[model samples]
Target: MGLKSWFSKLFAKRVVQKMYDDAAMAVQHQEQILSYLVDKGVKTEFGRDHHFHAIKSHTDFTQKIPVRDYEGLRNYFDRVVKGETSVLWPGQPVYLSKTSGTTSGAKYIPITKESIPEHISAARNALLSYINNTGNAAFVDGKMIFLQGSPVLDNSKAIPTGRLSGIVAHHVPGYLQKNRMPSFEVNCIEDWETKVDAIVEETLKEDMRLISGIPAWVQMYFEKLIEKTGKKTVAEIFPNFSLLVYGGVNFEPYAARFRELIGKEMPTVELFPASEGFFAFQDRQDDTGLLLNTNAGMYYEFVPQEELDKPHPKTLSLSEVELNVNYALVISSNAGLWRYNIGDLVKFTSLSPFKIRVTGRIKHYTSAFGEHVIAEEVEGALSETLKKDVAAVTEFTLAPQITPESGLPYHEWFIEFNREPKDWNVFIENLDTALQNKNPYYRDLIEGKVLSPLKITLVEKDGFQEFMKKRGKLGGQNKIPRLANDRKIADELKAWSVKTIASSNF
Candidate 1:
């Protein structure tokens, strides 16, 4: 890859994109992948004691396995940690992408050898699409700089041992080292104050293109990089850098800030990935949702809301699922999981057996005063209101709580906005309209047919999320619950909102 050829590819991203789109869709090419999982069972049975038995008990086989959470899976994971070969398929795991753990209360998710190829493949597709869009693979001859998790692993004296991060450190092909982060021992999840400084200091040691990670963490990293190097954007470090890939959580929240940090036009890709599987990646580079790994080692299912509320939801197969609708995801992985609810809600924008958007989490809804307000509804309202009012609200969160004094409760909203004073009133009205339209129960609640009235609080300059980030719960799977209708963390947010609102009122 000479500089001339690199420039040609970078400028000819559309051509590269056409090729990736065709290749990704050609799942038939990997028939052995699906066959390997269904026939071999892999380690899919790790969590559920009944996972395999359930698969065998039912004549249909697929219908018997129930979805289990991380806790259910942890029991077997203990054996896996002991390095049980039976737990995982017999393959040398080349890379382990450590993800934040929600089940064991630990932080790193261990990716196995069976998963590395697919993980690399998903990343490649993302890259291919990006190059197609920008024609900039010409910049570094396929070199990319990954801003990754801590590499020190578990033991300081020995090689790093985190499941995911360690995997990347030890297994990422030596041929690919120059394209990697500074070292296998540096930690990106360091304490907030030191984290940005560390990334800048460590980054000074590398010469590369492309960056991948959670957007928020990257945003903070860029801030320090700017301060330390006096460079306004990441582009200044890797002048020809073209792609930014991020997964986990809604990308909408940090979009504006990242744009400001980048200071130039480039493709920012959204990836819909989970520990269970690398489910999807941005298909068109510029498109919002992700392209499903339908042909991967997983059989996908959807559970409708009505059934989800039932003792057991009726399930729909891949061919049976539809679009413009929300459904709980149930996956049967090569690891032998069947009907496992991953607790995510997604809607399809197209019907080509791939490409969909994750609207929100099944557990992240705000239901107060008999009104069920979901992230999707809030997202729609925010976007609709933004376009209609031409406002510039950077971030917003809905927090519903109960007052300890009276059994009665009210809803509180915190928004980081910079619109007109009168537009504030219109913003509230638009908020009401959005709520009413997204869910009917909210409309009745708004009309006083229900309890608690919704109150809006203008969060300080940086907003409540920034404050939450300051408290050490900012990035990666750490979501500020929108409607903690139960007051778990919503109580804390409520207390803060009240203090801010009251102080502002006075």
Candidate 2:
């Protein structure tokens, strides 16, 4: 190994050791973080309003601060945006992470100086932990690319504002600057297609080893690379490329397509990161669960999934959580978010050191006919079916077809296949059976004849891409929702549907 790789290995060993030590005392660390955040919050305007000074325990916290989404916290956020000091945190945020909002048009999440390191270090440690585990640090010596949003910032806000990935780009450690690919000028291109074309040109000849991004956009990049060079696979273009670092979306649905594009299965590191906080990272290759960052300057709470819609849902600290039960993740961070519901639903895979797998989003589900099917169930069903079939899918979404012309109403799956399944009937049957097994409610609905078995609509190649592009959400952290409660997205998908298979499938 070269000097850089050797140093990386040495450093990774120390960091991994520290992480192990921290994980061992996860509860203590979380309690300390809660105390620290409360102490600091006591001086802020929100703290005073929420009676933070009186919160002595987790129960007290639950009583004092109600779980809220962005809309609930907007009053304080508005004050912060207007240049008010200490409206939320102790002082003004270093940056505002702008994200797409549901009810609100745009969300500006504060990234305080104290909390920024959590985002940066969690990502770095994820890679370092990989190196430490596998004793492979050579990837550190080669070029790394993170296909993300443009790093350009909008200074018009009280604080600098940009997409979370763009904000993160400005903080890439100086040591990796030389190893990072696609020069700043290329990254700054406003249009995603133009930016991707520029990236393909810049990194084509480099010794790329680590490529990171959301799976959908990265697939686009891979396709572009293949189209540009007439190469059969990504591994053929950059032989040294080995590690894939990804977050923002589950990788299972795209796993088959990615394996085909790369021509081989390589190591991957999954991250659980969002504008709210960097919550977890995959610490062990053998394990699918992401180790929650207990020592990070954030406190976590999980509300039982079934109780989420209630007026006063019961909240549990990390210590109180049990295995395999879905919970809506709530957090209080150094960035001034208090008891904020991040909307993600996660299930604890291991409780010894608190490892979790994101199951779905609280709002992103299909429940049109009283069969509550989540993202995890749908992804799991598809993933299981793919394992048994010879097929590759590019993208897909599930929505309830409440009003099909003639047959019993059922779930509609809009799928864009990279390679069509050899037997469509078997694939659909297996997929439907898998989903039924995962969700008992769905099974009941199917068995009772209340809903028909799910039907597939083969979307034309690049159909989802065209849909996202037309909606102006083509790239950079934007993704298609796996399951929707209504037919809005499903109806919109019809324009891109393959008309040939439309009648035949139904």
In order, candidate lDDTs are 0.59, 0.92
Top-scoring candidate (TM-score):
2
Which candidate achieves the best lDDT against the true structure? 2
Model 2 stretches with alpha carbons more than 4 Å out: 500-506
Model 2 clash number:
0
| Clashes (N, CA, C under 3 Å) per candidate | 20, 0
TM-score, per-candidate, Cα-based: 0.79, 0.98
Estimate candidate 2's alpha-carbon lDDT, on a 0 to 1 scale. Answer: 0.92
**What's the CA error at residue 150 for candidate 1, in Å?**
0.8
Give RMSD to native, each candidate.
5.0, 1.4
